[model samples]
Target: MTKTVQSRALSLAPGASRREMLNLTGAAALASAIKLAFPSGAMAQGTGPEVKGTRLGYIALTDSAPLIIAKEKGFYAKHGVPDMEIAKQASWGATRDNMALGAKANGIDGGHILRPKTHLYTTGKVMQNSQPLPMYTLLNLNEDGQAISVSNEYRDLNVQKDSSPLKQAFERKKAAGKELTAAMTFPGGTHDLWIRYWLAAGGIDPDTDIKVIVVPPPQMVANMKVGTMDCFCVGEPWNEQLVNQNIGYSALTTGELWFRHPEKILGMRADWVDANPKATQAILMAVMEAQMWCEKMENRQELSEIVGRRQWFNVPVADLNKRLQGDINYGNGREVKGTNLYMKFWGEGGATSYPWKSLDTWFVTENIRWGKFDPKIDIKALVDKTNRADLWREAAKTLGVPGAPTADSRGVETFFDGTKFDPAAPLDYLKALKIKRVA
Candidate 1:
């Protein structure tokens, strides 16, 4: 079978795409037959995964390293999903549209996505014509490492951690008849919520004091360079790139807003996971191993180089390396070295990678605070349906991951602004927020 498979693969056209090769060889589909022959999460001796591959999407952010590293380091191939395609998405909105299309329609099965997106897509809040695209939160890709950056126009104001200085600066800009804009990657994404929380904590009403807009992660620095936005929140290495280019200064990493806050997640279509359970587990195991690789301090430089290659992020290694290693130059005269605010891929005992249901509850509640979800929406039901922490645990067990959490909830979370969000009482958390759009 190996010889035949290799011969058939070598027989493909010279310039055949990965998708075309998979189709012609029936490698992905044939692996599904293997699934029936074996059992879910149980591979037959010397056999490949349920499917050879599936398309996944990602933006050029550094948090997407796990998926990229998984493909780059042969982790995916090792797990029998050798044909995994990690495609670059143009923007978060594009990611959403492609996700709604699904892999069967030339779209991605899943990839690095915002935590709130699963809830948004599942409920059809951000889908086309309110058509729900059921998705599952398989893994928390990384924690913290996202930052809010200010345009160089406000350099003298010296904003860092606290966003209050921006409140007056923005008010002055607005009173002068100039539009004050704050940009985030997506409407209900981590960036949007982070910037909103930062602004609101500093007494600036995001809805009233500033005009919020959607800017793709890569376009953020360019927009700020052109004076299109006052500040923007997004994941590294864009924030690092903006500082390197002298276009903006970092106010604070999202970790400062809420220490070790969850960011991007590995999300997939529920239908795809249901149809290819073993393949799903294969992909998860591969990504989990990659996350462990990314977490090692010694591999930080090498990790940055691989992701910064032209085929991947096309960014300079200098822009990614420093921040990835916890050395941050805020570009506002406030620099910190060896800080604990770096991006975390796998915390103590795999804490960073585990998909915590409580984190999902916080994201959903924040969306509700901003009026993205109806106040009457059942937050618990939404979290239970969208967050697939059970699958994460199963994959971890198979991988022999040590110290995976046994409980679904991580308990109460406290942010930098002295506000606490108890996952058990999401409504009370919402009630404590003073700048909410909800009644």
Candidate 2:
């Protein structure tokens, strides 16, 4: 897809006053001018229920932009949701559990979730829950430019650039009598799923021959240098960080799988929305606006600054911005431009804030494929339950950005094995799988 990211930047302060504006056409100065003239005010036409207070939880990642942008840009307050205590949780599991407990017990109302956690919590197919806090995906963060990187030793073994080099590296490592270990941030998360999928497609056994471990993003580089693992498949800055430090090199990027694959979503509990429909709708509208703002190409430098702050990803802006703009450095002193995978606002590259059922359905199908949940469940109904695109459309239209977002969140995925996955028919896909499923 040809993206028309407006070259805009956030002219606001470091913390909350900052608002990113979308600039189309790559006109840098025009994009900056647009950021200066963004239409920010109380949203009209939404008669949301009165929200006495608003609270949301998130873990630090670039994908958390919608939530961060919504807050910094005053979209929440404009939508009548101010005084939210944006808590920085310790881990992805902690974030989800905290939100689950808080939302359920009248603590926090909504949260950001790693896609798999959202799927697991919302469906309760395997981990049965009393309240199934059915989550609706509000919007997509970005099509991640995730990658799997390996040590310099593996690179010398002849892993190429055009494809999944990490997979090839794994094969080379096996021949060398070294067990390949790959690290992902969260289990059942996009990082984990992508890494495993990448490995499996390369003919490596993600479950057996290859070992998988969960490591925080920040620690990935350190661990690699110390030999905790050979390579890590993770989000930008981390992968880029590895490249800059000369400890490793890029094997393959997850975007290589599907460049525009849905990577992250705004997730909230079903009961939370049930009691606060107006509030939920308002929140969706605010985040949707933020998604658009992030689409601007010019606002990237500023975004890199905000995301790199200690309060967020806690890294240097140079490291963050270098990759944010697609200029990549594959450690061992290699640099390549056009590798930035950061998603810009105005729904960069057709990425919307609202959940696409097809995206959710894809995750659901993968959830069953990886044995994270049961394949016997009603996957179709569950996907529908987990995605609130219908609600998001109503709110987005009322808020006046545009008309209803499409409900194209369902489809079939054809893999290299000549396998077809109609997410609508996940059970059949599961039955046809060649790999063993966990009992």
Candidate 3:
């Protein structure tokens, strides 16, 4: 059977595309042929992924490493998806827009996305189109790599992890009729949430205390250099780029706000997954392999090089390497030597990749806390529908990893400010926050 499948696959025209092959021989036959052609140790005998070419989108952030790595290192091809396309989006908004376009429109099948944004997309609260675009998270991309950076002017203000020092500066600026401007990658996104939480933790209301603006990740340094914004929160290379340019200092890493907090996620449309379960599993399997590869210490150098390429992140490899290896220089004469707060792709105990429903609950509740959505919504049900842990388990199992665990919740999550968030009582957690817009 293997020989027959191999012969059929080899018989196709050399330059024929996967879609063309599918049109010629149907999806099931193409999947079988491709499966036989590129059999991995974990490949099981079953209906393989549909042989449709997937255009996976990603922003120019370091957390996008897994998707780029999978495409660059042939992991996607090794898992019987040879026609995967890794697209570089301009910003998170563009990424979301493309995902909403779906595969038929030549948009993305999926990509790295903010967890809560997926909820917003599905609920039709935010989008280019009003129709609800139901989505699900297959796995988390990375954790602990995002940071808040302030201009060099704040270096002497004694601003460290807390924003207390900036509060006085903010008041002076406001008195002078110049409202201090703060920037994040997206409104109600992870960076926005992180910056808001950091500011509110320091008694600064994000909405009332300052002017918050949206800036793309790659353009963060340029905007900061021109003194357009006082401070900004975004994912790596940009934060590290600011330090490299000597224009700003890393005031705080997001990991310092909430240890091992969820950052980017592998989000896909639910209807896409439902229609193409095998293809979805194949994509997840490839990413799972890439995640394990990215977690290794020895592979950091190569990983950095691959992601820092002109086509991918378009940044210097050195800037990307520093954070990945945990050798962080805060650009304020404060050096963190060998910190464990480096970006984690796949840690022990299934911490990084597993799409814990609890994290989703926190994201949704925070959206409510920030007044992006109403508090009357069912948080648990939203999490259950948006987070597809069952799909992650299926992919992990296909990779020869352990089966799905008994529970989906990661239990109570604690923050650096000593605030505790129990997923079971999200409203209680919201009520505990002193500065919030939620009624």
Q: How far is candidate 2 from the true structure (C-alpha RMSD, Å)?
A: 13.3
| Cα lDDT tens digits for candidate 2, 229-338 | 87677777777777778788877566556555677667776777777888787787777777777777788778777877787678877767766677766655566777
- Evaluate all candidate structures by whole-model CA lDDT and list the values in order: 0.90, 0.66, 0.85
Q: In model 2, which range of ten residues has the least summed lDDT?
A: 1-10
lDDT of 1 by residue, 350-421 (tens): 899999999998999999999999999998999999888888999999989888887988889999989999
Question: Could you tell me how far off, in angstroms, the CA of residue 134 lies in candidate 3 after the best superposition?
Answer: 0.4
Q: How accurate is candidate 2 locally (lDDT)?
A: 0.66
Task: Give the per-residue Cα lDDT of candidate 1 at 415.
Answer: 91
Cα RMSD of all models vs. native, in order, equals 7.8, 13.3, 6.5
The segments of candidate 3 whose C-alpha lies over 4 angstroms from its true place after superposition are 1-46
Q: Identify the leading candidate in terms of lDDT.
A: 1
Sorted on lDDT, best first, the list reads 1, 3, 2
**TM-scores of the models, in the given order?**
0.90, 0.79, 0.89
Per-residue lDDT tens digits of candidate 3, residues 310-335?
A: 87877899889998888888898888
